[model samples]
Target: MNKYSYKDLPSRRERLFIALRLPAHIQHSLRLSAELVQGKLDFRKWTDHRDYHITLQFLGDTLVSDIGQLRKTLRSAGAGFQPFELRVSGWGTFGLEEAPKVLWRGIEGELGQLNLLQKRIVEATSSLGYKAELRPYSPHITIAKKFLGQVPGNEDKGIFGVLPEQDLSDNSWLIQDFVLYVTQPGQTPMYEVVDAFSFS
Candidate 1:
């Protein structure tokens, strides 16, 4: 399973990624919480609650031909390890402080264990020819993307000020399994979990 021959794959387009899909109740709670600050910011779109996920490894685009082997590799990667507790908390942005590009909520608890899971996924699958990202993992679930404008200098008047202290410790989940999701590029909330692997 470590190596793959390109010839064995059937060629068809799919953007694939590995992630932990948030449970329905958590997603609902997260959406409600995010709505509070969302009004203070200008975003072109908010991702649907059903689409929320915490990605473990972004596998990027792949042909449908590789999916079968990819699923097997992922299953092997996710074979061991018991479920651990993880919490969703806080909020942040990526890109510039004044004009953010993405708005996302933070994740906490059992981070080292989360990193280990990420590492195993990459190591087990990278040999199949997907380039492993070297960037440090910063796990977050995006609520919205494509910031429309800059935040005012006075942090208190805009999103920075609007954000209140959050503690979603009660909003925690057991990190038990990972899913392989597929989507056609540029489709809205069209993602589908093609396969899943549970930790033993």
Candidate 2:
């Protein structure tokens, strides 16, 4: 007789997602972009650069019991997407400039492949009981959220407006793998990669 049962396995509910992790250099570049306006903004929670990533699929409040199944599904879903080059192109927000909910950096290059991979992930998990967000998938690295108020108009224009010509997006990173992450809400550096599935 076994001393441990499946019921006795350690488990916890998690807010989770699968994402493409950025390299150190690209990560710093994004932080620099946000830093350009850090002093000007007030009452906003900026994301830590270390947590920057491009979310492919968000699995909200996942049950610990379902992880094994999800892992297998993710591996199957991720297999067809060969490695691709991804570049950060520009900035965008979830709402109007004057009243934004989330500020993010936009993605370009090989996005069609990115979308196809995400489509497979969504389709794979739908039958397993994962519900994809209804909104169309827009890939970006969220730089900040929970905006309490807006920056002064001139400064806002300086930052959020059509930004002045800059070399922010010239760097490109190869995305060879995607990973599953567990997010710790109300914690510093919320997303932690728990497992990675590589593309062939």
lDDT of each: 0.80, 0.78
Model 2, range 1-200, lDDT digits (tens) per residue? 02234365537566788888999998898888778756655436888999999998888887676877888888887786788888988777787666678878889899998898888888988989888899999999888885566456654453455343455655798888899988877777777777899886
What stretches of model 2 exceed 4 Å from their correct place?
1-11, 150-159, 162-164
TM-score for candidate 2, please give it.
Answer: 0.87
Best model per lDDT = 1
For each candidate, how many residue pairs have backbone atoms clashing (under 3 Å)?
1, 0
Candidate 1 weakest ten by summed lDDT: 1-10
Evaluated at residue 153, the lDDT of candidate 2 is: 61
What is residue 160's positional error in candidate 2, in angstroms? 2.6
Report the lDDT tens digits of candidate 1 across residue range 1-200.
Answer: 11344455557566788899998888888878777766667788788888999988888878867777888988888887778888888889898866778888889889989989988888888889887787788999998888776346535575666666784546888988999987645766667888889997
